[model samples]
Target: MPPASLPSPSRPWPIPKLHLRIDDLHHEGVDIFLNVVNPKEALHEAIMASFQWLYTPETVPRTVLQILLVLRPMDGVAYTTGTQSHKEIHFSLDHIKRSVKRARDEIMGVLVHEVVHCYQYNALDTCPGGLVEGIADFVRLHQGYTPPHWKPTGGGKWDTGYERTAYFLDWIESRYGDGTIKELNEWMKDNQYHRRIFKELTGRPVRKLWKMYCSSLGDPITDGFVLVSKLIVKSYKPLYPPTWKGPDPGFL
Candidate 1:
């Protein structure tokens, strides 16, 4: 018998009943958003990004059975709400308009971030909010949709969240192993969130990791030593280059 080929990972994850609603068709933001992306495809791509990062094909989440996106005039950016099997993503049309200069990337980035919440295990809600947000953005960063404004500089406690914590995790992924973040997510599946998960993953406490990461970035470390960064390429690049703030899209 010939060696069987490995299963292709490109097999699509189970997508829910996808739906889209535009609160105001006349809104210029809606026009810009439509011009930038088709809703079904955008949502589908976001789903794929989440699945690719957080699960193997065999382990993909089957809980999400519906995803409805509401594009409306709202303060802040976006947010997701729903039961385990169904979720609604509310996007801010005003923010879309503001991001018209790079609407496609911004819209897609936010979608990917929110979608991760739909699927990621949250340590039964015991995970710190910052870690939750960091994982979301980490997925976004891996997807190659990092905003131009994002800087990799480290500061303000390790789990500070958003791009800052995402970058810190990126450093860990590069220095430790390829699936370090994936392992982090999987570890959270059945276990409660604990800071020691960092040590378990990297053999060092997160504080020490953050300290090293800060000093690597030319930022002051609390330990009174400035270790030079090896200048590791910002290659949070995934096994397959593709490609969030949190489950809640409070900030785009």
Candidate 2:
């Protein structure tokens, strides 16, 4: 069964023209995919998650005219590429086969992530790739599609990407209040990315915030950084969205 339905915006956000292409029509992965989900519904739902979380009708990007989904045999889970007006998502049949039992959730999760790339700004490509990937996973996490293996623990930097940074962003949004993440994205819309944006969003240095986040998790970082005891997190809610234990994301 699909885990849970992703929430849609109260009012509809405009959906771009969506198209689908299956390069390996004969692949068993394609059968699993086609049997489990409708492409149109899947894409629409993916766009819904992205638009609901990342934009409003008034601020949504209109430059995108089409989103084409291409399912083919490839090395990775998925990736998105396109011109200003057109976007293409290449998904791996091999990955789909590997995720057969959770094909619906896995496919939809990847779709939502790639769709975010179609719409989110990258500070003229100056944003860290980890942050970008985290934002995409943030949306997926919110969609109730978090894979079984995902969790919020430590060892790497905050922007280690994917679930690690996604959980961190969720904590930031919760502690600071709504719109902080949205504003961060807007700040990057026209200007080049700078660490100062984190300051502007949370009134603290990014490095400091990362330390506190590590502390909140009771992460054992004995390097030069201050070790915030795990007790501090006891009085507070989890850093991620409440829906999932690790919790949820940001943007307008």
Candidate 3:
């Protein structure tokens, strides 16, 4: 199975065979879930968000032949795992019940994170688990599915998983330019995970970049301004064009 294609609104992702298996039909989570999301569209939307944020049509992987989402009575939250050609997402119904007030947000957030694991590169499966989880949440962060509880700046290690790393990556892309993370991901496609990829992509290594990121907490635009300006200058081109501050719908 080849990887899925990169995303495009003109061509919706070819959603693979989607199957939902609910372990405890009587669980209160089931009631709440049925009250909210439709399994078909929910999974489709999750897949699209992953494709949209991480992969472009030319680069999206087409190998995932199927995605089976299992909503069962289990511990913790949710996780995705399977062979390269198939993926399974095991979500805890109890956790779903606990998130009843924000069921839609919580469900979609977890789904997006899990779906990313299905398609994202893992440096031949040697990438740090925290970084892997962080990448998943990074995609989730970009999907506009952030939980209301998520706060951007908290003094934590840059790779401190989940939203912390997601926000760090968000800042990295904002500083380096859009698709910088995608380039980082692509770099890992055939190579081992290396901190040097940061330098390769942005001309600054990860440590220095992280330090600059943290110091910029008080004034991000000022800190990011320099790198953004440099990218605009060095990366300029016609037809292809140079990077811009934030999304340039103008290009479209």
Clashing pairs in 1: 143-243
Assess the local accuracy of residue 89 in candidate 2 as a C-alpha lDDT between 0 and 100: 98
Better of 1 and 3 by lDDT: 1
- Model 2 error, position 105 (Å): 0.9
Q: List model 3 lDDT by residue over 183-208, tens digit each.
A: 87877789987777888999987766
Model 2 per-residue lDDT at 108:
88
Best by lDDT: 1
Which stretches of candidate 2 lie above 4 Å from their native place? Answer: 1-12, 222-252
Q: lDDT of candidate 1 vs native?
A: 0.81
Q: Write the per-residue lDDT of candidate 1 for residues 1-252, one digit (tens) a residue.
A: 999997766555687899998899989899999998999999999999988888887788788999999999988888889999989999999999999999999999999999998988898888877778888998999898888878777555676677877888888998898889999999899998778889999999887777677766766544335443444433343322111233432211
- State every prediction's TM-score relative to the real structure: 0.85, 0.86, 0.81
Please identify model 3 stretches exceeding 4 Å from their true place: 1-12, 219-252
- As for TM-score, the candidate ahead, 1 or 2, is 2
